[model samples]
Target chain A: MSRWEPDARGRLERAALELYLERGFERTSVAEIAERAGLTERTFFRHYTDKREVLFAGSSALQELLVDTVARAPGPATPMEAVAAALQAAAAVLQERREHARRRHAVITANAELQERELIKLAALAAGLADALRQRGVDDASASLAAEAGIAVFKVAFRRWTEQAGEKDLSEFIGESFAGLKAVTAGT
Target chain B: MSRWEPDARGRLERAALELYLERGFERTSVAEIAERAGLTERTFFRHYTDKREVLFAGSSALQELLVDTVARAPGPATPMEAVAAALQAAAAVLQERREHARRRHAVITANAELQERELIKLAALAAGLADALRQRGVDDASASLAAEAGIAVFKVAFRRWTEQAGEKDLSEFIGESFAGLKAVTAGT
Candidate 1:
């Protein structure tokens, strides 16, 4: 067998999610994940530090996408508009891998520890978005509120997208959720 | 030493926060907390399940206050208005214990693990607020969005209150944050 494996990271992630779903996150082992992927444990370690890391490997990339999108938003865009654009960019990324996202979400929702980790990652994303907004000269409080409100919309929209059975685009849900947020906060 | 102790819970909480701040959360132990409080470890156990619980003992009460406030808002109050009221109620409670809240905030800020726990508690409070909104005849999406937006305002405002040096009231910060949130989301 070649020391270099093709799509090793992707294979390991799929294997890890499948095993986590089949046997639960706590009961699954790194060795089992690697074995299921038909890759050696060393290859698994090369991709992820532990079994849990497999579930969150994309978080950094997602954060970068969100921050970059927010940073690149038009000068005329409001803080909320910049954040909305960022959320739409993130939704586009996830839309391409709906099945994988669904499986991963199921696995995460089943475990309390994973849920806490997910919350932490979401919080980090919000912080990143807030920093990006602040760099645009948005005030501290407004930046933080806009970033957090954007995240809240993303959370609601993502859940709705995952649960509903249809071809409805995640971006549509994002837009709808943002509008819902606006109307509710408008005190109407 | 008498087995019965008055204010045992409060004493344990204060001791735990002091030890956590002095030695860091990872370095602090329940035994040391009890010793610092001049109480038995058994008393500490009776009040809290673990050392971390000391920092979060008020979370349940806070969540109850939030949900109850939302539930009891005047019949004509909008969802956002109800959430605003709940946040003000929560802020008022924290205002009475400013010193303790500040110290606890410092201790949690210094520890990643405790930060995750803090996020989880906030998420739970958001969920409780959403349920209360739903019970008030608010739709599913609106309830969640309002609840989450309220939490976002609370987070930004609470951090400002703790970090700023002034005689300003927390409720004032909460009101300002809600106004900030509305302004940002107004896309102006």
Candidate 2:
């Protein structure tokens, strides 16, 4: 918890989630969260815009990771394949944070306001992915379809992974969920 | 315009959308919406809880229609088939409202807060569809996957339908979108 530590942001996030879970998101204050982390409110503000940001700070990075992967995918890969590959690659960013992700998910799911924010974040991710696809010369409708479907696959897979207690790889679950999506769409 | 008219809700919705589009959602009040509709504030309150609800009043009915269609689909139909059928069936509810739907879509798309609510409604519809599938004996994961994929298709198809100015039926667009989803997932 020293000021020189490299995990200041991570510590703040952990503390914020703990306080939010214990006191309810509406009841938790930034001061209390910072105090719990052995840091000052200024430090909390330095890391996050507000308490809600602690739960959603990864969204921008996740979107960037997805778009970058899609843009760099092999030429032969189809739109969905590119998206799936992007999802697989993005897993690395989340792999080591399984516990943190699960706790964050729980906090978000338990609160209606937080859930709305989560959906908005997911929608933004889909939009960003679609934009990335269009940049790769994919048509708008097809780009949107692939991106939205990829997000749908991610939501289901992430829920399963969190519930499984890190027993399975996030990428493996994403692959399986993508296969499940294919199966459902294939009508068999 | 008469007090005895049966379309109080319709009148209020049209007026509300007009006001929202002109002055923006935040600036539009229920009193202004009601006055624009030639009705009193009580009538507006009677039909919608707030200004935001005016844009989303159809969500519950839309969810019911989807769940019912899925529940009543032929026993031999696959989960995706059931969802596709539900989307087709649900289209009937929206088919005649093309202009209204387009305007509503415009209003929601122009505002971030409304877009969030739209996403929340779609998520709720997905959850309802998954629940209906489970009631028909499908497993949780498969039900959720189909439901979420169906929602993604719906979102894409709806946007296309609105943008196309009703040149084709909503159901047709939905079918084509579902096919596109299948093609994307199939990696072809």
Local lDDT at B78 for model 1: 97
Write down the lDDT that model 1 would get.
Answer: 0.93
- Top candidate (lDDT): 1
Give a tens-digit lDDT track for model 2, residues A36-68.
888889888888898888888888888889999
Report the C-alpha displacement of residue B146, candidate 1, in angstroms. 0.5
Per residue, candidate 1 scores C-alpha lDDT tens digits across A41-129 of 99888888999999998999999999999999999999999999999999999999999999999999999999999999999999999
Global lDDT scores for all candidate models: 0.93, 0.87
Give the TM-score (vs. native) of candidate 1. Answer: 0.96
What residue runs in model 1 are displaced by over 4 Å at the alpha carbon?
A1-4, B1-4
DockQ of 2: 0.72
Per-model TM-score of chain B: 0.96, 0.93
Clashing pairs in 2: none
Candidate 1 lDDT at A160 equals 93
Worst 10-residue stretch by lDDT in candidate 1 chain A?
A1-10
